[model samples]
Target: MGVAWPFADRNEGFREGLELALDEINRQGVLGSRIRLIEKDDKSSVTDGLTIAQAFANNSELTAVIGHRSSAVAVPASKVYDHAGLLLLAPSSTAPGLTAAGVDRVFRLIPDDTQIGSTMAAYAHAKRFNNVAIFYANDEYGRGLANAFEDEAKAVGMQTVDRLTDYKDLNDLRRIVAKWKLLGCDAVFVAEVMPDGAKFVSDLRKAGMKVPVIGGDGLDAAALADTAGGAAEDTVVASIFNPFAANEAVRHFVRSYEDKYNEAPRKWAAQGYDSLKLLAYALEQAGSREPSKLAEALKRTKSWQGASGPHSFDGSGDVRDMPIILKQVKDGAFQYLTEGARANE
Candidate 1:
């Protein structure tokens, strides 16, 4: 297996998640031999990701990969893996375009941007947010999510008051916030990754915009509340995994992860762990490490339970009917939100 990710300060949870799963799988010796993970750091850069993909493709021994957290990287890198006939399992890249090309061997563990963004729009509409502003990064993940939310918002009869990208600095952010205030925006949807997403939340509060803040999985990080401080309070996000889930697998993962890492696993970790678990299942089903067989086995997956949730791939290699839930930042942690009660447990 070839594992690649940026491995940046805030992104280490993803690597930890993969490592934990790798350790468990290797201990079981499921393949009748130890699984050796060939790791690389893509730095979340498209150029670096493509370079790494080509290198991974060159390695004839490598049958599969779990990597490239950013869609900007994964979208392009996936083409390389597809042509090489290697299984590319994306743990976090939610851009629809990642699998839209019908790549034979590419699969995504999480629900695509459309599912996440539409869920947010539905939640916003349920909250009676008549008009909303969108703040997104100028990249594949951001643009895809923003467009999806806008489409759903329009369908829900909620107007998108303003949509802006690439705010250069705090001054620029405040200017955008002022414009949103003038536009009578009642909610803000952020489509950015951590540090950037955290900064936006902090700046939005500094700018004194008290309107609701909603975001996709990009903002659902352990570092979100830590980086944004009290500003992160009440921020709502669409998340893939609920850490507080009562499922035995979830509870076991949480306990084992905490025991090993001395901390709770984030959504990225759960997805990463699922990627490996699902891949192991594919390997078992195929009974061969051959790339084509593994790809076919993966395509046939249905309701494979993991710490994250049930994963069933569609014809396009996109996870089918993956659960997307609403979570709120409360007391410096993301708690699952109960719809009617609006209560955090």
Candidate 2:
């Protein structure tokens, strides 16, 4: 088995999760043969991810791939895995195009950006933020999320004041904030990964912009507080998993993870564990290493319980009827906004 990420230093939670998951799998003897994981760092580059994925696909020893965290990397890397007839399970990539691309071998543990977008729009409506502005990363993940949010906002009769897209540049973010202010946006929705999202928030604060900022799962990384500093307070985000959850299985996983890593596991870690659990279940049901059989078994997976949540793939190979959670940054930490809290606006 092999696990790939966009970068080595950037995704500590994801890396820790991959290591912990492999250890658990080895201890449980889930595979008849001892499973070994090969880690590859793509440096968050699409070309590098595709290159490594192609190489892995050609390697007969690697049964499947666990990642390529960003949708920017997952989109192209998935094509390589598809060509080689290997399954690629993305732990964090939420770009809707991955599942909708009509690729048979690609699957994701998290809901697509469209789902998150709809949830964000619903939250905006609930909060009565009628005039919304969108800021995106200018990449596959950002652009897709912005587009989804825009569509949903329009559906709910909310007016979109501005749509700003920028590459990984802080100066561009300053320009966008100025534009949003001119457009009279009441709330800002940022759709970008941690790096850019954190920087945008920090810069917005430096510019003395106080409009509420809402983000998708990409902003759930631990670095958000450090990067955004005191400015991160009151920021809202949508997530698929809650590490502070009290579920029995989640508590066990959290305790085990803390004992091993000396820190609370983030959503990425939970996602990695969930992805491996799904893979193991498919392999167990197939009882063979053949790609065709394993893919079929994976599609047939229904109501499988995972550390992240209960997962069931729809006919389109996407997780269906997934729930989304809203959290707010308070005292420099993320707190789950209860149903009533969110409903009460």
Best by the lDDT measure? 1
Instruction: Name the regions of candidate 1 deviating beyond 4 angstroms.
Output: 8-10, 168-175, 338-345
Candidate 2: Cα lDDT at 74: 88
In model 1, the clashing pairs are: none
TM-score of each: 0.93, 0.91
For 1-345, candidate 2 gives per-residue lDDT tens digits of: 778885456776777776777788777776576567788898888888888998899898877898887788888888888888888888778888788778887777888989988899889888889889888888888888888899999999999998777534556666766787787778989898878789888887876679888998888765788789898889999987765555676777778889998987777778877777678788889998776677788788887877676778875677865567788888777777845332111
Measured with C-alpha atoms, the lDDT of residue 159 in candidate 2 is 92
Best by TM-score: 1
Candidate 1's residue-wise lDDT over 181-221, tens digit each?
89899999999988889988898899879998999988987
